[model samples]
Target chain A: DTAVSQTPKYLVTQMGNDKSIKCEQNLGHDTMYWYKQDSKKFLKIMFSYNNKELIINETVPNRFSPKSPDKAHLNLHINSLELGDSAVYFCASSRFRTSGNEQFFGPGTRLTVL
Target chain B: AQSVAQPEDQVNVAEGNPLTVKCTYSVSGNPYLFWYVQYPNRGLQFLLKYITGDNLVKGSYGFEAEFNKSQTSFHLKKPSALVSDSALYFCAVRAQNTGTASKLTFGTGTRLQVTL
Candidate 1:
């Protein structure tokens, strides 16, 4: 079974277009996270939710918002997408909201804004 | 703030030879280090981690890493390099005492190229 999964593996849209990427995890984990990887392969954490509660919110812009309906799902919505939003976004899950836990990542959603 | 550094942008190795990818980290307190691998167009795969206990940690795909507190490094190593092992590797660190909100910081990544 696919432990962590994300919808729309590839997305191509124009500037000012709004988009949303959905993520789900079946590992029975209590924590979920969102990460962004740039063209240079630099990965950074964008947001994290533990048991449906917002736990970590990095220095991401207000245009980026993350919503967690439950413990198993965390979705990202980008408003007024700009050219700088062209990159791969990854969804991850861990056992808990602890630093020692290793996160399981999904296949990732490649978002390209023209 | 926790940060990780991977000095080499790419490491080339021949098949059947051993390979090593260096990594260093800095944090205010103890660190939870991890190694992840990314194949072409794929997400990051957890290879190994060092939270506590033994300094040497063994992970998937015949990969291992040694954590050195004195040097603040966790270098990934493999006994034999395979052609399929060519991929981008990332080193990440999380500060243990930074509460539950602490996030994992990743390095720029090192591309391992294994040639025949």
Candidate 2:
């Protein structure tokens, strides 16, 4: 079974378009996270949720929002996507506190704005 | 204020030789360190973690890391590396932040290219 998975492996759209990426995990983990990796291969944390609670929110733009209906899934929504939003978005999950803070990630959604 | 640093942007090693990827960290209090590997087009895979046990922590795929308190470093090492082990490695640190769960700060990343 796949531990973590993301939908629409690649996305290409216009500069003013809207996009959403879905993420799910089957490791019975409670915490889910979103990360943005730039062209330089720098992976930075965007948002993190532990058991449906919004825990960490980095300096991501307000246009980008993460929604978690339950503990098993986390989805990222980007509104009015711009060229700067073109990058790979990763989804991750971890079992908080007692689980040593190790996160498992998804395949990733590569968003391209033209 | 926690941060992890993988000094080398890339590390090259001969396939049958021992390999080491350096990582250093800075945190205010006790830190929980982790090492993850990412193959091309894949998500980050958890390798090992240092949650307070022995200084030398062993993990998946014949990988291990040493936690040096004095140096504030957690470097990943392999006795004999394989060409297939060529991938991107990340070092991360987490502590008691104001978040609901402990948040991790990841290093930039280290690309390992094991050659034959």
Candidate 3:
């Protein structure tokens, strides 16, 4: 069974288009996170939610919004997508807010904006 | 502030030879280090971690990592390299003191190529 899963493995759209990527984790983790991997493969943290509460919000633009309806699900919604927004977005989850726990990652969603 | 650094962008090794991927980190307090591997079009797989224990930590797939606190480094090693081991490796660090350190700071990543 896939512990963490993300929907729409690949997404290609034009500039100004809006899209959403859904993530679900069966690990019953309380803390979930979102990371963006650029063309250079530098993974940076974008957002994190603990028990459906927003915890970490990096320097990401306001155009990107993360919604966590529950502790098991966290979805990212991007508005007015631009060329710079093209990258792989990954979802991860951990049992709790501890540094010792390894986060389980989803397969990642590759977004291409033209 | 917490950060991780992977100096080498890529490392090549022949199959059957031992392999090493270097990683260093900086944090305000104790660090919880981790190694993850990602194959083409796949997600990151947890290899091993050093929270608190022996300096040498063993993980899945016969991989191990050594935590050198004095040097602030945690390097991943494998006894024997396989072509199938070719993948992108990432080093991450989380500050134990920072309550908000639940988020991991990842390095730029290192591509390991194991040639047969």
Cα lDDT, all candidates: 0.95, 0.91, 0.94
Residue-by-residue lDDT tens digits, candidate 3, B1-116: 78899999999999999999999999987889999999998999999999997999999999999999999999999999999999999999988867663878999999999998
Clashing pairs in 1: none
Q: Among all windows of ten consecutive residues in candidate 1 chain A, which has the lowest summed lDDT?
A: A95-104
The top-ranked prediction according to DockQ is: 3
TM-score of chain B of 1: 0.97
Q: Could you give candidate 1's per-residue lDDT for residues B12-34 as a string of tens digits? A: 99999999999999998899999
Compose the digit string of candidate 1's lDDT tens values, residues A1-114: 999999999999999999999999999999999999999989999999999999999999999999999999999999999999999999999977555899999999999999
Using TM-score as the measure, what is the rank order of every candidate, best first? 3, 1, 2
Which stretches in model 3 have alpha-carbon errors above 4 Å?
A: none
Where does candidate 3 chain B have its weakest 10-residue lDDT segment?
B94-103
- Show the lowest summed lDDT stretch of 10 residues, model 2 chain A: A94-103
TM-score of chain B of each: 0.97, 0.96, 0.97
Give each model a TM-score.
0.97, 0.96, 0.98
**What's the TM for model 3?**
0.98
List DockQ for all candidates: 0.74, 0.73, 0.79
Model 1: lDDT equals 0.95
Candidate 3 DockQ category? medium
